[model samples]
Target: MSQRVIAPKSRGFLFLDSHPGGCRRLVEEMWRAVPDPAPAGGEGPVALVIGSSAGYGLAATIAGLARVGIRGIGVCFEKAPGRRTGTAGWYRTAATARLAREHGRDMVFLNGDAFGDAVKEQVAGLLTERFGGKLDFLVYSVAAPRRTDPETGTVHSSVLRPIGSPHTTKTLVFDEHGAPEVKEITTAPAEGDDIEQTVAVMGGADWERWVTFLDGRSLLAEGFTTAALSYIGSPLTAAIYRQGTIGAAKSHLEATARTLDERLAKTLGGRAVTSVNAAAVTQSSTAIPGIALYAGLLRGVLGDAMVAPVGQLTQLWDRLTGARPLDPDDEGRVRLDTWELDPAVRKAVAERWSGATSGTVAELADLDWFGDEVRRLYGFSVPGIDYGAAVETDVPWPSAGA
Candidate 1:
């Protein structure tokens, strides 16, 4: 990695590398100096959050702790530590721990594979030893390609291909020029095992592990609620997500919710809800083969209708905590993306896609927003940053598949 800290490229072309995830650490710390609220007349209920790192996890963590004032433990299943120019979740976790400890707020951070048995046991112990053997709420939001079972010792790897007939499409990918242009591609349908494996990884196995563990230890509370996050990718991403191995996992995941709900309801009147958030470019979203084009279209076509995710997080946080309160639907997913299927938004973006003539992924992706999101994902989107400033030291670079 280069020692020189280039004042991070911002705006226009080079936006994918915007580094928004890095902001998590800073946001956590800033919440600290504000003083803690009293528990009796205090802020909100205490909670434990899994996947409280970058993307949705980080936002959910911040919104609960900061915006809605719910002090809690964040269980992040990723590698590394400390907040820096890179490693969005690591930095964010470090910052949250600091604030939480200072306020006498109980918070524990576990950086490991969520699928492992040891991980499951460690979390169970945390609940038993710390939070009085009761968790008022649980949020399971994990997106990973692989999982290892604790007992059966089975491993699952996900796939991404549509079912039915073999499908082929064109994708815009990066080249030596640091620009993206469309190219032809072919994708095959997933085999039966492929679907099962995908379900094992993306499905509700891990979710069931946590909930069952809680129930076994008798740590579950009455009227307790849990939710799993899911995405149904568009027609464009069907080959890589919906129709692919991952979709199979999601199907399993959707089913897991029902099973989990059945188990939980037998005890504390618990229910497992599913929240299907609209598509936005998180780290996971950006890596897909053809969705960049869909994201690009989302950008150009949505206009001001586009919801900057941080803003959306604020709303989501409120809904989740009942801070301000909300009205529920049949399945219990707060419909944030209710308007996503709106005829106007999709129709406009479709027209833009038809007229697209550029080799740049930015144009197809609502480049300005996409690029901004890329930056914000890493915590580099603060307003009034002096572009000319230089750092005197080198720092660890963010690693995706590192």
Candidate 2:
């Protein structure tokens, strides 16, 4: 385990390597941001968090353990360190396990392909034996570019293209000076089976399958509650995001939520709903077209109104645990993006968006903060961590089968 000033290795937005110490620091900060855990509710409330390594999934896991005193099972796909550093999510999960133990909470972390049948079976077995065979809460937050269907053995990849005509919008891109600049970029419409593949990969199929499998085994507890994290961008990004292929996938997910709710309500009196969360700097969000600029301008316009991932999920725990009643929008979905979609906030962001240029974008948007946050996601540019000091790259994940 050797580490010394792990430099940024990136091709565009994708980070190739991560810093263990900095990633641990990131998770520790998330743990600190939420309320401390009450005494563990013994055999009372257990949660299953799919895709629980980064972004909203990771935050939901931390919130479940800290805010709701839940013992949880977290499923993620992350690589271990070898010649190069591991992924940021890997180090974050390791740190999260440590924090859970410190808080007297038990967490089972599984590292593998969560979309496959093997991992799902393993999770079911663990819940049956280790968790009294009942799951109280489930959070499905998987964001992947591609997925191999477990039943059919077919691979599906998600696309970020628009549905109908080409959509041109002001987007942020890197200039020759390695700085961000606003440019008008047009994305072509999806062709062939692009929309179908995107829906197959990102839609609610997997979420529905997970629920059905668990219910088949009689693992869903009475009054069981589930929330799948989702996002509905504003009109600024409507063409590329909200009305795009990914948008179709989100619609399918919401439809699945309604169907699952009906099924659960009739059988176990449980409910499943999609939580439309606020936009933030996440590993997946940064890769989406127009989202980076939207997030940057949003930070500048909304300022203190912008909520972090941890805060959003903490509120989710409140709703799931009965501390707060489940508030759904007209579409029967939990709308956490209300602040981001506020009329005042939208007007300000749109004004800045229309007037933003390569020269004036710095004045209109919080690009600096956005860049720093993106870097911090990969375990670089983190505060209080000595980047020059040696740290362990091969950190041990303290869980069986991880």
Candidate 3:
């Protein structure tokens, strides 16, 4: 019998699943939630997606193939099968690839550090040899802790700290037993070069680099479009998120989108833009201070309108393919978070935020649902999966030998 490995807990979150069922359910949800595709009346386009193993990137890839019949190539950094539990992303990619194959659509996953030039070259080669030497869509959705400059070899790591001063806020922490607790946590301000370092790690330099490399190699098809994701939360999180280290990075990312838009238009008759997405529990979002409480409250306020990654990306596709006209903000960026930022929703969240305490958290916010979302990120808490059954962690790469 295969060894039985249970979920692991750390820093108040449980890491579960040594199987693929949970990821399969996520993909199934995406297919079921998205509206049926209206034929675009042409050959299907090819997509190149960076950070495509999970979260927004994964959702985009699945939506592209399943809804619109686009062939996709995904790039991500996930653990290969080994002694320790393989990353949930690994199973997700494997299951998504299988789904794509079942539908007779092509989906290739390349697991590697997308920040490096080597991976870029490999993707370019794949495009030339197998994908007709051009891409119609490119999606950049990487969220990394540290990034090493491919040119300077200097390493930059990002931090979740406020900008100018220490800020105290209600933070959520889970115990080993998976019980949620709210505590008053204070985060210090960014130190010397911390902002710059965070920007280097999380900013648009690498995104622009990818575009430049693809454009220079003539890998972008005529009238090609590319999009990168960003976020601008409510005033409640401005101190810790929008006005903080990560916010600075997002600002840079949005700025890069403008520059790339002009560059694409002038050079390749293409377009580029940033899509400001809604908040949902993602692997990266869970680590941000105060985000857990904020997300739980936001969900409570928005309810059914609260778009997850799958919904956000599906809506993005509608805008991109002219199924719906692009309704962007004044900055020419898609505001996918508009629903979450609606006046009524924001008002409700603010009211709840003011009265929320450890004892009152569950009553004030959707902690139970929020916790389930967090567990879903790691392929846990998903229905119909037998957690007690022995799981085989050794799974093949979805795009092996491709």
Candidate 4:
């Protein structure tokens, strides 16, 4: 172990260094929140979680192993520790593997460019050789800023902006005093191929490719189900969220779900759906323009009623496993953000949104919780970690970079 003291280093939401001990503790907390007693024996259910290192993807992997007793293959692109500490996703993946071993569950981590064909072929080989060529679940929760097209070699970058016109809204930012302040910010609309590029990067093109690859190889298990995570925020964020460039990509994703659902059902009696999740402080969400402000207010209004990733995924598992029947919306998407978009909740949040100002923003929103959640996502501000102590930064991933 290359032991050295590490402290939280940051510029805005970009967390520079990750704490191994703190990451392990946070994973432990998430692990404990789900049910225990993984499947006892036999080659059990199998799951392929693309982008499985952080946020919804990581939580879904945990839910699969701890609650559903499924063997998991996680694919993510993460950096290892070198001159500085590795990415938080790196440490989090290591900790999740440790817990999986403790519970006698099979968890494999493949660190690579998941958007490329090489990693997809690698995953296919694992399924065929190790898991009897059967896959029960494929979770697509990837959040990337850019993607290089495997066929054309063209790179597409996703953007966050209002669709047709510039939208001005109140956003939360820290003042020079490090106090929460509401500031009015206007985001420019998409120009040229901005919408097309975002749809290429964040849309369902890659997801469809993955499904096509596995099915062509005859690797899809009977009754196999796949899902991709999505979001549709309230009116307060509609200009920049539900009706933005990213939203255009999300629309494409949901459309792909319909197409995949039909094809999977015809071929293997399988299913595909997009799971629209609620707002929270995730690595990706914190980067969005107005999500932080909206999420903070949502947290304040719906405290405790706001489900964490693990809780939301556990419910999803129940729906998938026949413990409960699937309840999908008219669009054939599982709506997990119902609570977030409830009329009463929306009314309360809108009132708060309209009345918010720099002075009263902190009081009207759960700014403390929002800040803490962002810190915890990168393995800082986790309870009971001595950040000053020297710790190992060079943690090994069992099969990373292979």
Candidate 5:
């Protein structure tokens, strides 16, 4: 048996079984949010979700299994059980697989580096053997720090920096005591191949590669549809978000959507789209500079309108496979962030941002609520969980046949 230990702060809870109940609650919430099928016996679309361990990917998988009764294949890279602990995503994946089994749905989870060609080959083989070489939908929602180029054998790391010049912004940082503090930070502009590396690590190259491999081997079903998730923030954070290095990468991703759409139409009469999601407190989003403050302010403004990962993915499912046909914005992409960027909402957020300061941050924005949500991402601070209880660190992953 492995022993469990807890981290004081920064990374939040570290005990393996600190909050299984929290994870279960999230799973149940996702299931409850899934819309019922139409009168004509809804379309049960089989899906392959890349990076489907947590956040939007996990929510999409849950919605598919619970509402549509769709068979799913989820490929994600997560920390395996070790001597001390495993990642929150590790436990979440296990819980998701178990919930699918309870619903009489087959949810096959592949735990490995999704950027490698070998993982793609293994997914193709799994589909051939178990799913009859047919996948109706493919969802790409990967967020990684680094990527190793399959063709060049070079490693690329992504950076979040402004594009044009040095920009000063208010960001959240942990103090020596692990408490969150607001600080003014200035980031230099991206230069000397930074954009290329960021694009390479975070862009649509890997997504296109997966589609090409699947299409070539006839693994995709006829009329199959695919979607890659993206984020476009308001003008306030445009310098650091939408118009920054990550923004460049997103541009490439959206461009790849068009290319894949053309290829799918020409080949199997399929379609490819990009879904722009709203801002939320996700594992990856919390790490980005200036995003936390923005999220805190946005949460304060949006309040009830703010949609979490599960809500966003549920909406995506409805738009994709509901009674009505799919619709896209002028840029040929699904607009799921409309509410977040609503004129009134943006105006309120902007006003809050202008008056925000370290002294008044707590009262001006929902920083406490934001912090609680962040802890919830790691299975901590959830209601009904005893934090002092001893926990088993060696919980078995359902996908691993435990």
Candidate 6:
């Protein structure tokens, strides 16, 4: 790390460094919450998780198989998060899949873009051949910044900028420090097609397409389910979140969920659920223009319990396993991290931000654990991982790049 990178921000605190141990601890804790697998060795209770290599996407798949007794396949466009990798998420997934098999549970990994018709066909084929062409659940957790239309080949990139007027925001560059310095960001409003493409990529277009393709192939069973994850945050994030290109896509996702919910309910006796999970530092969030600034600030202010990544995944697990849940009304906008965003927690974070002073960033120093956790996510700080070991880049990096 460079000196300036290590140096304090205006608030005078070193950039929170990586801690592999802490991240492992968090993952272990999350795993414990997941009830143990009931019986994954059955014929094949399948789940197809689109973004099943990293972040909560991967976590969700683990909870399903490891806790809820589902034998499944994970589809990921698996380039290591934060940095590009030669092999995608499926590369690492292959090894994990092998482990699942040893325990008499089957896990297949298919790597490629789901935005293409060919890729969708391949997934359906995998299901047909590998596990009776049938699945019980499907989870869509794709986090791509760009998608190329298979027919047109026009690559559409998504952005999180204001719709009408120019907006300035604060953001922290990765490996750079505590406080987010002011940075100006602007994005053009979504044109009709932009909205369509965003919907095609981030929203429920691909999700529904996957379901339709599977349903046509007779690959989805009764009591089946399909879930799409979306985010609708606070008013503070309104400009970049609700009004940005991504949000336009999310609008389509939310709407599509309702349509798909009804279709699945009628066709497969299934349901469509869209979870608006709470935020934490992840490859997707780190690149979302100004989100890093908010994350860095939020980390310093909130308690560890408020970092809801694992808790959110467990909630999805619990729902999938037929556990009783606090009822959510019709908006379909159920908050997975309600516990984190409780009135008192939010109030305390606001109060902390209100009281902080420059050159005395004690709070950020304390919150360094989350930053440490972020680094470990890339396999940077595993217990016995040897950084000096000659990494075989020709093959997968075993861990995503830190």
- List model 1 lDDT by residue over 273-318, tens digit each: 6666677778777766666667767767676776544455566656
Give, for candidate 3, the lowest lDDT window spanning 10 residues: 1-10
Against the unseen true structure, what C-alpha lDDT does each candidate score?
0.63, 0.88, 0.83, 0.88, 0.79, 0.63
Query: lDDT by residue for model 5 over 244-282, one digit each (tens)?
Result: 999999999999999999989888888899999988888
lDDT (10s digit) by residue, model 2, range 1-402: 465558787877777889888888888888888875567545448899999999999999998888887886999999888888878999999988988887778789999898898998999999988888999999999999999999899999999999889988888887656777788888999999999999998999999999999999999999998888999979989888889999999999999999999989999999999999989999999877888888999999977768899999999889888889898876769988889999988999999988888898899998888888888898988899888777778887667532
Q: Estimated TM-score per prediction? A: 0.81, 0.97, 0.95, 0.97, 0.93, 0.80
Q: Which ten residues in a row have the lowest lDDT in candidate 1?
A: 393-402
For each candidate, C-alpha RMSD in Å?
Answer: 5.6, 1.5, 2.1, 1.6, 2.7, 6.0
Clashing pairs in 6: 78-88, 78-89
Q: Poorest 10 consecutive residues of model 5 by lDDT?
A: 8-17
**Model 4 Cα lDDT, one tens digit per residue, 1-402:** 699988777888887888989999999999889965456444558999998989999888888888888885999999999998889999999999888877777778999999999999999999888778889999999999999999999999999988888999888888656788888899999999999999999999999999999999989999999999898888888888779999999999999999999999998899999998888789999888878889999998998889999988888887887787778888989988888989999999989899899888878899889988988988888999998899999999865221
Of 1 and 3, the candidate ranking higher by TM-score: 3
Better of 5 and 6 by TM-score: 5
Ranking of predictions according to lDDT: 4, 2, 3, 5, 1, 6
